[model samples]
Target: MMELDPAATFRQEAADLLDSLETVLLDLGQTPADRDLIDAAFRALHTIKGSGAMFGFDRVAAFTHDFETAFDLIRKGKIDANHDIVTVSLSARDYIRALIEAPDATDPIIGEAIVEELQRLIGRGDAKGAAGAAAPPAAAAGASLASGQGGWRITLAFEEQILRNGANPLALLDDLRELGPCTVLPDLARLPALADLDPESCLIGWTVTLAADCPREAIEDVFMFVRDEMRLAIAPLAEGVPDVRPGFTLDMAEAAAEPAAPRPEALSAETASHPLPGKAAPAPAGAELNRRAEDKGSTVRVQAERLDELMDRVGELVIAQARLSQLAHSGTDLAIKAIAEEIERLASGLRDSTMGVRMVPMGSLFGRFRRLVHDLSRDLGKPVDFVTVGEDTEMDKTMIERLADPLVHLIRNAIDHGIESREARASTSKSATGRIELSARYVGAQVLVTVQDDGAGLDTARIRAKAEEQGLVQPGATLSEQEIHQFLFHPGFSTARTISALSGRGVGMDVVKRTIEAMRGAIDLTTIPGHGSSVTLRLPLTLAIIDGLLIRVGEGRYIIPLSAVEECIELTAADEARSRGRSFLSVRGELVPFLRLRELFDAQGAADPHQKVIVTAIGGTRIGLVVDQIIGSHQTVIKSLSKLHADVTMFSGATILGDGTAALILDVAQLVSLGQGRADDRTPEAA
Candidate 1:
């Protein structure tokens, strides 16, 4: 078993806190007067600071001290949320990440500069108050937190797993201190003997006494995250009693679930921790520890390399299982065939379990973009309302990470070029604010992500003129709007006259195209003049294995992603004669375009008396792929092609068959996009 690293745990917890901090900060910009959002931001900072100090992130802890104070002031109604506060706070959020990642390399001056700006913003608020001016809008509207308590008190007993949730109890305790003069007594009555103790659990609870100068909400905010997990009660302190002290013992079973990062609702909706199965009840002080101990096994952090290694092993097992299946079918041994079937079932279950482990929600990628949009709107002076849909869609972890840079480029392009200026939009009777939407959804075996904008659409005339000037098109070229837009993906192709911070060096779209293609994905462009434009990307759900429909084209065998296959039908001699002049298939009253793989690949061979067509759906269009034979279904383990075959758009990747022969996997999206309905059989289409 690998040893648990406390430092690594601290870093991961700190990262989660930072993500939560960012979410709250961005939310404050939209609803600046939201005191709950403000306090939420403060709590995130306090937790990061406390955890940092405990885990030896001194720079992070020290920097967060002043940062927490700024938010604390907002919570206390001492300051109001304004553009300057939110902007500087966002910058501080990024800086805190830098401090966490590389403290030694990060310039301390940046942090000092941000803190100075924050101070100036706070000072200006103080200035108005000193002049006896009217309170800020929020405070005037009574949106700010109450200043004085109504003799209220709170008793909080957090679940034992609070520490696991990446929340530092000490941080909450420290925040309570900020409320007013308060005394905290730690309760260790529920603490088991040291031998049976879990360091990650919050074994000790706390009782507190405080002056009635602070509101009850302020105290409750301290235990907000663990509120559902633990017991919390409040009441007014007795008139004669200086403080309320209640002694309570926690039920061991009640706090069974650890308060890990999942309860925060931020941190990419971090998963919750469930008690490990088969865990023996609390052992006495002297009992021997279990060597197979697994703590709160609902979630475990394993290195990416380890997962990759495990996947490689699974792939080999699948191949071996395939060989067994092939042998079982060839031989006439019922018992051997049954064994192979059982092995197949076990292998399939293991594959699914392994894949699920690597699946993460698309929300993790979408959450980081909110800050990007916020910052871009401010910088570009473009009042764009950014929205996201289908954020909960699950995707492979590897694909999710690689998707970030390309998506950033597309989203930036949408704002910088696809969307019009506020004035431009207003002139066209459009709303002052343009809308940029990012969405993702599962389409068959692939995920479709779209970045769309409601602004001035692509200027095809302008694109054509630029293409002509650059000698990319002939002088009298009559290219379609899409053909003109394709020029945008050419290297160094930009129409902007000035280069700004966000874009306009003509170097982004080409990179976006190449990056998406490298992942065996395809991108689409659609636009309507004076209306809007959208870019849709189609990507495979996983890179490892998939169920494929295997077919033979001449002497070559190819696999099609089974998710896209609707059905297989015979291509009779009469249908072939009819399609000889036109590659069209009549499927359930729909005229679908068809492609003959044998002819398309120039595979020299005699025509088979019998041919089959695999009806596949891409996007919403049905396309037929004619093959010589249907080889049934296959457990395809995808293997990426070499650089030599990378430019070939017809095939996404290749895989090893049961007979140890290589079979290429067809690129269904690309084929469908390139297939033109009512077009000539030999004339290939381009997208």
Candidate 2:
């Protein structure tokens, strides 16, 4: 029942189609003989051109026609999918996007340049020559016949209140004609005599036969504007059916004169099963066939926001069930307990289903990087091969969408700065073509995504010198190589001797860090001077709900994401008494620093006789958090805190308990860094 803006829908679909086309083209640039990729790219362009024309984007449709023709040649093996051809087509794809977004822009010169480039790539000297040479007379003649394939036969009847919608049925009929070839037959049976006719009321209806190869989707798209106030039946016509004739008659009285016999196909399944094979089975009944056809024809293409909304509702149901289970557990009745158990099971299953809806393969995110690497290599004049692994791993769609920009920035940096030149690589006994591997894997409850390059790695000495010169670190400070590498994320920090358009200005890595942190994720860097460098990003699988280990800090209850908690140990009186101050804990012969939540939060209550230590790890560092009581695990629905407390680094966000009490969600990375003395030494007021 919800209405969507037709223009906005067209734009969204256009962007997706362009993205897919770009990806396939980039792949073909590397593997020119790939027929599947060639066909896929062509299909995407063909669909975009067709849909653009259907939606009144004539300029875009016209511009894309040439590129589509070139790809068509590639599809038919007339011309190979060479790198030069792919590059030119990729540029054309961007031009098509520009045309779709702004057809009226004053940029004739830009269009001319793109067309010239396309002509060169296709081995034609000019657009006129290419158009004349490629255009076939036979194909021109087949156009109208191809467009006249059977499509929707719409029978529309409107009520008297149709005028209230400020719509004219005749205008609606005119609009349908623009979609394809249409023959409209007016139903004069509903029209009144001239003396009795009300000029304002819509008494006449129409039955139209449209011939279009466009799917039922485009047919329904035509009626989107007047769907509510009209009675409409859209059925596919038989092959080669002629246009509807004018002045068609409906003889209702003659049909009422004779008793109709039941169709043999209408017999029950039990009766049909006993039919003799030699007699031939009766044709399917019309009503039964219609039902089956409708079942096959109906489909839905939902926008992602709708799925997110549904997931949120499912999350709410989960929390409500949690509350019910708590109340039922406190009651004495067995019936209440049984019902609560059933509710818990059902809610859990529903949660999984909702999460599944949000799950999308990493391939969708990985596909775009091929194009990124291609463009960056071209810009930098470097030869690089971008390899991806674990693209089949699935993650939340929201996470994947947000990951794109950051990933692009990282890939650009890798191609421009991380990889060495072909001469430099050959001198170092490395391959002429540099390699960058983008891989992902599931670690515990988080997704570990890594971008690695086989080139000259980070220069620790240069980085340290840069850090000191920029006043990012204390003068004469003794820091590890890893600490020096972290300086790459500082704002306006770049070690490049020469600035280039692709990178060098050093504005992107900082943004990547901020974006990842905002998602409650962390980014880490690992490098070997001549081997290569790898940047790994660890992120939670979902943002909405999480498994949390609840604990009490002073009078406030906080949750530590269960994914980060390795194990909990009870600190005995002897161990607690022996260890004091900023450091303590010797677990499995490894010294781990411990922080007491009571002391950290300035609690007034005395420490419990028995304290619990929750061991947690971030990256490679392990630390322990001393808490009063381990309140066990919970399914937490994350609710962000207000702007007033947004700067609080200790708490990532907050959530509401079933009892209407608030519990802060602990930031494990911040806590681990604090316990390891990695938090900023300067006070907030000082900064």
* Number of the top-ranking candidate, with lDDT as the measure: 1
Expressed as tens digits, the lDDT of each residue in 563-616 for candidate 1 is: 778989998877766655578767776777888888888988796888888898
Q: Compose the digit string of candidate 2's lDDT tens values, residues 1-687.
A: 876565666787788678867877887887899988986786677666656765677788777877877776665445666788888888888888888788787375777787777767777423444454453787767544434345657666565655643445765676578667888877666667899988777767677888765445345544443443454555556532222211112233421221221122332232345432221221111112123457568534587889988987987887788888888988899999999999999989989888877888898899878877888788777899889999988889989988888888888888777899988999999998999999999988999999999888888889999999999899887777877888899899999888877677778898888788777788889988888889999888988889999898667788999988888998887666555433477787666777788877888877777879999987777879999898889999888788998778888888777666779998888888787663234211210
TM-score per prediction, in order, is: 0.75, 0.73
- By TM-score, the best candidate is 1
Candidate 2: which stretches are off by over 4 Å? 3-6, 33-39, 72-81, 104-106, 123-299, 678-687
Q: Which residue pairs does candidate 2 place in steric collision?
A: none
lDDT score for residue 327 of model 2: 88
Error of 1 at 666 (Å): 3.5
Against the hidden true structure, what lDDT does model 1 obtain? 0.75
- RMSD to true structure for each model, in Å: 9.0, 10.0
Off by over 4 Å in 1: 127-302, 563-626, 642-651, 668-687
For candidate 1, the TM-score is: 0.75
lDDT for every model?
0.75, 0.74
